[model samples]
Target: MAMNRVQFQSGLSLPAFLARFGTEAQCEDAVARLRWPEGFRCPRCAHDQAMAFRRAGTPYWQCKACSHQASLRAGTLMEQSKLPLRTWLLAMYLLGQSKTNVSALELMRHLGVSYPAAWRLKHKLMQAMLQDELPRMLKQVVQLDDAYLGGERNGGKAGRGSENKRPFVVAVQTDEQGRPLYAAMDTVPGFTRKALAQWLAQRVRPEADVYSDGLGAFRAAEVAHAHTVVEGEGRSRCEAPSLRWVNVVLSNLKRSLDGAYHAFGFFKYAERYLAETAWRFNRRFHLEYLVPSLLRATVHCKPWSEATLRGVPTFRTEASC
Candidate 1:
């Protein structure tokens, strides 16, 4: 199963994808190939000339010298997972291809899995997609603003005034044309100085020029960077070459969230979805590059567990209790 990078990019049709890597046996072979590109090695003894065989119909590599056995799924995301590899691959494709966002219900129908299974699958992929490293700093002119996101209100105002229903999110980034180069979103209880500062410190680079409305939270940002505040009617920062691009960028962000993921809940999971959207927006033009990159990411990444997939808080029992 040596899949070429180009073949993967053209997009794997549902039937074709299943035909190639649908069965559990096919999946194990794919994982084995991915895990040991050159040859199999024993996990415990570090022996390369290990004899691999199936135990209980599951592939296990046994070290010839020490007879140590290890499953192919060990140390991989697919470890301890019952979901089919084809199902996982399809889920990844759907998540990657979707322009807006895909809901769990939608995923359930798409993958033909249970609602709970679909929900868990979607978040697990999202968790893997989240960039662990901090994004590169937004250089040049950066647009800074806050927007609220969540489900529609029962009888709320048409637009802009329906802020009460959803949580407020702050976004900061630079855009080239309509593509965001760097972006970070944070869910806030409300627009407060403390919340804004915490987000800025984490996402924004020091000494970057900051632009915003007359929000006092940005006032402290001046300590480490150049800060400009827009005030009064008809005041335009767009005159500045660096600041002008933010207009298109901001519009795209709003359109994406409003059109695609109409409503999202609190801060924790919201950030993951935001990151997912940002990845899509940033790579819109480079689909050829983006598709393979996502596939490669899936290779090393582990399948997310049910507990981690939900993003719900889990309580640990105290020894004292």
Candidate 2:
């Protein structure tokens, strides 16, 4: 048996990450570069030149023409955050590089922040990850499966009827050799054909071949290129060759959720959690680039407020994947 290259790759170790983005200045520079890779242009006037200054320890860039001012944290997920840039960068690094998900409590210990702050930070980053994943559409050969997170409580209904169970869909695209390529996973309202149809429309390309289990809802895949059903009796779904990658991805996803946070409000936050796992899985091959890539995604993500994350009156209900 040979070693797994992805598992053995020289990822960005903590020491290396610290050396590169250990300080506020370094983190600030990294954010600046990610935001304006070509150079700073005025958000208002689009001027090529800007003046840099520090106000109460916060870096700001002023447009040379319009005199418009932009804080380093402005316009991105970091906006209005009181946390240091180094702390934000560190959170991104931890969440990105971890083989499994990190809990808010662990992040609190790592960042030395209060639990609420850590929770907010974690959700905000996860929201950014979800945003980054929303535009991805799996193509070519794909394996699809319906999965659920959380199990029955002591007094709750059992099996699929469990109120605690949060239904989600998982799809993995494979190459010619059947190696996994990209994964798309998200919480859906249920296994209804309407729900699955909406999910297929978003996460799968029209010309892609979708192979799934005998779930009737998956018949909705006809909305796409094709849907093939694979069935195996008296055998674990994971053991079935046609369903291999989807099952493997689900196994890893469940393990990560079960091992990381002891519990969460599955009905309320399952989408974010599922997206976090899928986001990392989709970017699994490039361990070293995880932080930078995550930073770029975060840079493009609009600011997410606590009210929005909490879902308020609009707390995320499973309308679609």
Candidate 3:
């Protein structure tokens, strides 16, 4: 739709957003239009010209031939969710529009839900957004580095013996005009050649030029691509104009964790936050397009189970709750 920044910012207002997509019916109609841009076809029986009927106040489509029924929320992030469609859309807008970040507490106040419910909703939507905007493997010149997070108990020590405090995150990505692209972060026991190689192998595209500091762990990266080490004082080789950008990314991440979550236990969920930041950074110029594109993309991806969504082991007692 070629949504510019002005349009994106203005469109997010409750009144304006509701004006276009106010009611659940209107939102469902938009979803149906987006999902079946061509026409309605029975998902189960492949029947065309399905008749839609409201069952118990909810709209349902039934195939005339096979009588297969499908609800508007079927196969979507909204599927099985208790929250209203307008609320979900508003949350998406807040996530997209905010410059710093919106906290679960703030969202709770905004959506008028309980803290736990709001937390779960935010996490789930963040996961969906993460899945929606899976970054393409970075090409051309790529920058690599590692950052330590959550290690205050050991007097800010980053490596060994700080396991309980915070784990290290190995990051690799490119910077295009101050925006990070294709960034990937992995929790590691410590930053090492093996860990760096593993992260690179999984997230980086082979044959792309790689740049990094003069770290021996990054030496093996040359096997896959042209590697250059930017040495000398004050020379930040990575995407940022200086090493400051990485610090900024880290500070923002820490602030988000501190203000919203208030602990390091949610590190698993923190990855989704990083993914969200990466999505925002990559699509900063076209946020409106990005948001809707993500909403649309979530439809095609496989639905995440509650167990995975909660980040609990299937065999664990926590999952029983």
Candidate 4:
């Protein structure tokens, strides 16, 4: 019999993680390396003359240009967070190592933090992921489908009309061999032409071919490239063999959400979660660099407060992509 190798293997073991990031100093060093790999420069005045030291037990680089100080956690997602850098690094480690999902409850237990802090850290990393840029766009042949999370109502409509379900779009790009390469998922009001346009503009190329079921909203694909419509009623593309990898991706996403979260927080935060799911999916083949990549992204992204994530931002969720 042929052997089946596990796709998701551990890149950084627990022992390795503990050795490198067991202390605040180590975690701060990692962040400093990522944040200012070239050298410390005054973020405000573009001056490189700086002094490195610590205050309140946190490392700070004081710029001589204006005597302004910057910390590793400053101006990043870790800003304003009371949790130690070690805690933040460990949280990110657990999130990257898991192939299925990691609940905030589990994160709190493992990281030894309170539920509120764990929840905030989890969401903050997810938010940072939304700001991270994928290395490539979805191109070549792509499969498109409308998907939803949340359970059906006890006495309401079924399937797509079911109450409490958060509606979203799933698109998977495949290589010439019909294997999945990358994916993009985002929440939408409904599968409208405008929604598709907004999603494709950011994630896909104008020369790509898009395949979807018989939905009018998918007509938007024709605006730039080839669009193929498959009219298969009463069947889900998630299990259909034709789309193949797209089905596998959709199935795994729903399973991960079900396995990890209670209700995926609120529907308002669905886009953030969905974007995060897509990020993990696209990086599935590279399990090793996941944590470092995510941590780097957190450095690149601007700070997001609990207030910013509470309801909605001025940019709007649909356009946030």
Candidate 5:
């Protein structure tokens, strides 16, 4: 039989990545090709032709008709950056391929860059990956659960009541055979029926069935689709086959967060970190596509800075979008 897409596929090896993106020009060419496959059209005027202008080692284009200029990184997440394209590509490779949490320190060591630069690059990429999650509706059957991050602080109240814990929901949609299909996760102000309704409207197809433990908020699931409330007994609840993927996913999420980031603040950065986890899990099968896919997403998003990444988080509210 041919290889199944479900099986994990190896991504670009270090040697392969080095060979392909060894030089600044090579990385720039790759980005340009991925960003505009057919040809370089003026993003402003939609003109099809431009004159090449040199910038550092990369090339920018001046539109012949409008004289509008745009750089390779100019309309992308990398806009206004001083770093080379090769450095950015290498960072993408390391972050994309690493199965576990790789810290900014690791990135600094790997890229031979300063601590601050590495940290900025790492957070930028993480923010990019988080936004890269497409607004896909989960269909058929979905496993829904409420989860919390933080509260590891000793001497504080633990579990749901802790002030330190930030609550979020995990929803994983599965195929008819129960294989995992797609997942959606995000931070919520609280696990209320109203919150569930908002999340359902955003992430769930109105026709799909939602499986969850007996939570009052989940009952609101009926407002959109069929809701089956199943409360398992004891450890069996956490190990139920119907909820297998979510359980495994939760376990891995905790491990990756704890293992990779030893001394980091979580309260301010929880959503981006969790979004990174969800993105990585959803794109697990096609490991090779992860880097290129993220690169494509970066091109579509507006440029942002480290200060903005730290300060201006785009919170989701129904009225806002």
Candidate 6:
């Protein structure tokens, strides 16, 4: 049997990760480089020159042009955080390297922080995961499927109507040889035609064709250039060749979510959780670059306060692309 290159590749080992980001100074240098590849620019005045210095032992950059002082963490997701840069970099490493994802409890143990602090840290990083612009629309033959997260509580409804279930769409674009290229997954209001149309508008390019099982609402995928209906349901639908990659991605998603978290507020925080999985998947082929890529995204993400993180629940708006 041939080895799967993506699964078998030599990823960044723990020793290498430690050597690169082991100390506060190393982590700071990495963050600075990722945040400003050319060099430091003033966030306020767009000046390219700046003076680096420490105030009360905290690093800050003063723009040579406007004299505005910006802390090392200012304007980024790490703003207002009191945790050491090493700790933040470690969290990114653990998340980017983990196959099944990390839970707050596990992160709390790893970081030696309280559970609440760990929870905040995890969600903030997940928000950073979503800061990347949405991947360009799938442009090849694509497989689509509907999936759900969460299950009924004891004595609650047991089917799709269950209050616990959150509906999401899964899509995988494949090459001419049927190899998967990219995947997109996100929550929807429901599996209605209007809802699917809104999602397809944002994700499916007009030049692509979408394949799906016999769910009538999937007809909304006609908003693309083409749509093919494969009639099946239940186990048969899951095994159907037309939807193979979508089902495979769905199965992996279920396994990862189940293994990483015993429970979470899936109804409210589904977007960030799903985005975290998709972000990792889209970057799976480049494991060595995972932490640095995540760091780059983190340094670009606008700050999100705990109150804002707790307040906003992302959903697909009705507006079409």
| Candidate with maximal lDDT | 2
Q: Write the per-residue lDDT of candidate 3 for residues 31-135, one digit (tens) a residue.
A: 788778888878887778788888777778889999889887787766767777777777777777676567788899998988877777776676766665444
lDDT of 1 at 302: 63
**Candidate 5 structure quality by residue, lDDT tens digits, 176-216:** 89988778778777889988898888888998988888778
> Which candidate, 1 or 4, would have the higher TM-score against the true structure?
4
Q: lDDT ranking from best to worst? A: 2, 6, 5, 4, 3, 1
Runs in model 4 lying further than 4 Å from the true structure: 1-10, 133-136, 152-163, 234-242, 313-321
Q: How close is candidate 1 to the true structure, as a TM-score?
A: 0.70
Per-candidate clashes come to 3, 1, 0, 0, 0, 0
Angstrom error of the Cα, residue 25, model 1: value is 6.8
lDDT scores of the candidates, listed in order: 0.61, 0.86, 0.63, 0.78, 0.80, 0.85
Indicate the worst ten consecutive residues by lDDT in candidate 4: 312-321
Off by over 4 Å in 5: 1-8, 152-163, 312-314, 318-321
How far does residue 24 in candidate 3 sit from its true spot (Å)? 1.5
Mind giving the per-residue lDDT tens digits that candidate 2 earns over 1-321?
999998888889999999999998999999989888899978888888989999999988988898999988888988968999889989999998888999999999999999999999999898888888888899989999888888899988999999888888999999988999999888887899988888888888999999998889999997666888887653575677778988889889988899998999887888889889988888878899989988888888888888878873111233221
- Sorting all predicted structures by TM-score, with the top scorer first, yields 6, 2, 5, 4, 3, 1
TM-scores of the candidates are 0.70, 0.93, 0.79, 0.90, 0.91, 0.94
Q: 232, model 3: CA deviation in Å?
A: 4.2
Candidate 4 residue pairs in backbone clash: none
What is candidate 5's local distance difference test score?
0.80
**Pairing residues by index, what is the TM-score of model 6?**
0.94
Q: Give residue 140's lDDT in candidate 4 (0 to 100).
A: 93
Clashing pairs in 3: none
Q: Compared with the true structure, what per-residue lDDT tens digits does model 1 show for residues 142-223?
A: 5676666554467866554553333444444655463346555445545677766655676667757778767677675677
The true-versus-predicted C-alpha distance at residue 241 of model 1, in Å, is 7.4
